[model samples]
Target: MTAPPPEQRPDRPRRCFVIGPIGNSYAAHGSPERAAYEHHLEVFEEVISPACEKFGITALRADGIASPGDINEQICRHVIESDLVVADLSGGNPNVMYELGLRHLWGLPVIHIGEDGQLPFDIASVRTIKYQRTRTSLAGTRRRIESALAAGIQDGFELLTPARVLRAIQPGAGPAPERPPARPPGREGGGDLPGLLDDCASVEDGLDGVTGQLAAISGAIETVGTLAERSGAEALDLLQAGAPAIARLAAVSRLADALRAPAGELHALTRDFSARTAALDSGMRTALGLVEAAGPEERDEGNADFLDQLVSLDEEVRAALSRLAALSASAGRMHLLSRHLREPVRDLSGALRQLRSAVTCMGGWAAAARGLLPAAAG
Candidate 1:
C-alpha cells in the first residue's frame, strides 16, 4: 500500500467535458488544420468514449450541450463544473486555450491531449497525451486513459492551475485575475478536493465492513465456480454411463440451481462493494495529497499523531481499493464460468428429452408386433 501521490482529487461530478477545436474559423475548410479538427472528433468518439464508459464517467462535448442562455456561459459553467475536463491543444485554438486557462485558474485537474509535434511552445513542457489517428494508436491511448482515470492520475496540474488570469480582458490589463479563496485554518485546502477528502475520511470507520463483504463475495464466487465445474463433470459421467434420461436431467437440474445461487449473490455483492470502493478512493486521493506542512515549531505532538493517522488511513484505503478491484474481476470471471457450466446441463436436458421419446417409440413398436403375431397364428 504505497502512499498515493500528494494531491487532492476533487469529488468528480462523474462527467468529463471536452474542450477543443471543433471549428475551422481560422483555418481553411480543406486545409490540414481542418482535417486535424475532424480527427480530434473521431478520437473523442472512438477512443475517449469507451474509456469513460468503462469507468462510469460520462463524456460531453462543447457543441453537443444546449442551453437557453448564452453559449459562452454554458461553456464556462462546464469548464468550472465538470468533474473532469479534457483539452485538445492541437492548432492552439484560442477558445480552447482561453477555457483551459480558466480551468487551471480554478486549480482543477485537466487532461491535455493533442497530436504529436503540434502543441504550442508554451504548453510543450506540459504533459500531453499525444496521439496519431491510426487505429492502433487510438486503441492504446484509450487503454492508457482508462487506467489513469481508474487510478485518479492527472496528466497535468499546478502549471495549468495558474495563479491568475487577466480580469480586465484588455491588453496590459489593470491587474491579474483575482486569487482563489484562501483555505480555512487548520484545513488541508479549499475547493472540491479538500472538502471531498474530509467527506471520505468520515467513512473510514466503515472500511472494515466493506473489506469483509468484498472477501465474502470473492469466496462465494470461487465456491460457485468450483461447484459448477464439478457438477458438469458428474453430469458428463452419467451421460457416458448411459444412465436413465430422467436421472441425468434431474442431476443436472440440481447443479444448475446450485450454480445460479452463488453467481447471482456474488454478482450483486460485487456491484455494491465496487461502488463503495470507488467512493473511498474519491476521498483518499484528496486526503493523501501533499499539502504544505507546518514548521517544526508550529507542530505539536498531537499534530504529529494526527498526521500518522492520516498516513495509516491512506495506506489502508489504497489496499482496500486494490483488493476490491481484484475481487470484482474474479467475480466477473466466475459469472462467465457459471454461464459456461450451464451449457452442458442444457445439452444434457435436450438429450434426455430425445432419449425419452425414443424409448416410448420402441414400446409402441413392440406392442404392435405382439398384436400382429397373434393375428397371424389365428
Candidate 2:
C-alpha cells in the first residue's frame, strides 16, 4: 500500500528476475521448511510483485517460468538478459549468490535485499535493503524498494561487487569464459554471425564515445586546476577580493563539483558498453558452438571474414583499455593535487572499473573466436 512515484514508464516492457531460496517442496506438508516456502511465496506476491507493478515491470522467479524447457538454461538467460535482477540474500542462499555473481559480471543493474540478520560477511559492504517479516516492517520495506527501483530506472544502477573490483585490479585477467551451453535441439542450421558482427560494431561506437568523454573531462580538470592556481592574493584581489586560503578552498570545491557530470556520463556510457560486451562474449561463444556442431566441412569464407574483423575489434578494445587506464591514473594525480576532491572522484572510479570489465569481456570473446577460424578452415 506504499504510494508509487510519479508516473514513469519505460519505452518497452522491462523484466525483473528474482532470485532467492525457495524452500524445499519435498518437506512434509506441515513441516517448518514447507511453511518457510509458503512464507517466501507470500513475500513475493505481496511485497515484490506490487513494487514491480508500480513501475510496469514484469517480475518472475525461476519457478515462475511458464514454458516447459531446460530450467537451468532459462534461469541463465534471465540472469544475463533481464533489464533488472532483485536478489534476496536471506540465509545467504548459494543459488542466489551464484546468480548475483553472474549478474555482477555482466555489469548490469541489480538490487539486493535480505532479512535483517542473515546477510553474509563476504558481501557485508554491499548496500542491501534489510527487513523483518512483520507486517509493519514489510510495508516499510516495500516503500524502500520502490524508491531504489525508481532511482535505478531513472538514473541507472551502479553496482560495485567484489567481482567488478577484482576485474578492475587485474587488468590481464578477463572473466573465465563460461562453457558454451549445448546448442539447443534444432539449432543445427547455424548461429547469427552477422548479428554478432553488429554487436562488435556497436561496442566500437561506444568506445569512441567513452574516449570523447574522457577528453572532455580531462580538459575540464585542467581548466579547474588553472583557476585554482589563481587563488593567490594578487588573483584573489582581482576576483573575489577575499582571503587567499578561503578563495583556494572555494576553488577546490568548484573543481569537485565540475567533475560530477562528466564522470557520471562516462560511468553511464561504460556501464552500457560493459553489458554489451558481456552479451557479445556470450553470443560469440554460442556461435562457436554452432560452428563446432556444423563440422569444419561447413566452414566458409564468410566465417573467415568474421574472424578477421573480430581480431581487429580485439585490438581496438586493447587500445581503449590502455587509454582509459592512463586517463584514470591522471585523474588520480589531479585528485592528489587537491586533497578535498575524493568524494567526487567516486564516479570516475566506477567508470574505470566498468571500462576494465568491458575490455576484459571483449578480449575473452576475441580469444574464443580466434580459435574458431582456424578450426573451421581445417
Candidate 3:
C-alpha cells in the first residue's frame, strides 16, 4: 500500500491590539509631567499609529475611549480579545506596565517598546525594542515595530524575540546536528534553515536601508521647504537692490518652484511605500501562520481536508510573494527617480551659489560708493 502524505494542521489567524496610558495619565503626577504626556501622544499618533496601520494590526489608544470607570478593566478586555499586545513603556507609566503585566499573565504574545532612556528595570529580562522619541527616529522605529509585530504574531508568546521566532518558523528548521560546527555568515553554526534565515535577515536589512533612505529624503524635502520660505522672505530685499538683479531673483524663484514639484512627488511616493510596506509586513505574518500549523508531527495525518487547507495556504503565500516583488520594484523606481532629481537640484544649488556671490560683491561695491560720496562731500 502507498504511504499517505502527512496530514497538515490548520493555522490560526492572528488579531493584535495596542494598549497604553493616554491623555493626562501617561505622565507623572505634576504639571511638569504634563509635557511628557503630550510628547507621548505625539509619538503615538505620528509614529506608532502609522506603523500599526502598515501592519494591518488594530491599535487601540486608551486615551481615545471616553468611558471612565476602571480603565484597567477595559485594557484587560482588549488584551483578552487580541491575539497579541504591543505595549509602549516610555515614560515608565505604571498603568501601562500594569496592563502589560496582565497580558503577560495571560501568556499572550506581547511586544514591548520604550524610549532609549526610559527602559524599566523589571522588563530587563524581557525582550524590548528601544526607540528614539524624536521625529527623526519615527521611520526606523516604525520598521522595527512592524518586524517585531510580524515575528510575534507568527510564533506566539514563547518566541518573544525576532531572531528566535524567525529561526523557529524557517522551513526545514531542526535541532542542531552534532558535528564540528562551521560558522555560517549569519548563524552560530552552519545549517540549511539557518542559511535561509540569513537570507531573510538580509532582506530585512535591505528593507531597513531603504526605509532610512526614504526618511532622509523626507527630511531633505522639509529642509528645502524651509529654505524656500526664507528665500521668499528675502525676495523684497533682492528687488530693493536693483532692477538689473531681476535675473538672480528669478533664478531663486525658479529653484523654489522646481524644488516644490519634485518634493511633492517624492512625498507621495514615500507615503504610498509606507502604506504598502505595512500591508506587506502584515501579510508576511499571516503567511507565518501556515508554517506554524505545519509542524512535523501534524504532517503524519493524510486527511484530504487538511491537505486542501495546506494547498490554500500555499496559494496565499504565492500571492503574497508576488505582491512583495511588485512593492520592491515600485520602491526601486522611486529611488531611481529621487536620484534623477538630485542632478537638477545640484544645478539649482550652483545657480544659487553664483547669485549669492553676485549679491555679496554688489554689497561691497555699494558700501565703497557710499564711503567715497561722504569724502567728496567733506
Best by TM-score: 2
The candidate, 1 or 2, that scores higher on lDDT is 2
Encode model 2's per-residue lDDT on 85-177: one tens digit a residue.
888899877557767766765555788889999898768898999989899888888888889998877665664553344233343343222
Q: What are the models' TM-scores? A: 0.39, 0.43, 0.36
lDDT of 2 at 352: 71
Q: Candidate 2 vs candidate 3: which has greater TM-score?
A: 2
Ranking by TM-score: 2, 1, 3
Listed per model in order, the count of residue pairs whose N, CA or C atoms clash below 3 Å is: 3, 0, 4
lDDT of candidate 3 over 110-211, digit per residue (tens): 778878888877577777778785767866887888787666446633533332443333423532122111122355334343432232353345345434
lDDT digits (tens) for residues 177-213 of candidate 1: 2233223233443334343223334544545555475
* Model 2 misplacement above 4 A: 1-13, 166-378
Q: TM-score of the candidate numbered 2?
A: 0.43
Local accuracy by lDDT, each model: 0.55, 0.64, 0.48
Off by over 4 Å in 1: 1-10, 24-34, 153-179, 182-378
Which candidate order results from sorting by lDDT in descending order? 2, 1, 3
Instruction: Flag the better candidate by lDDT, 2 or 3.
Output: 2
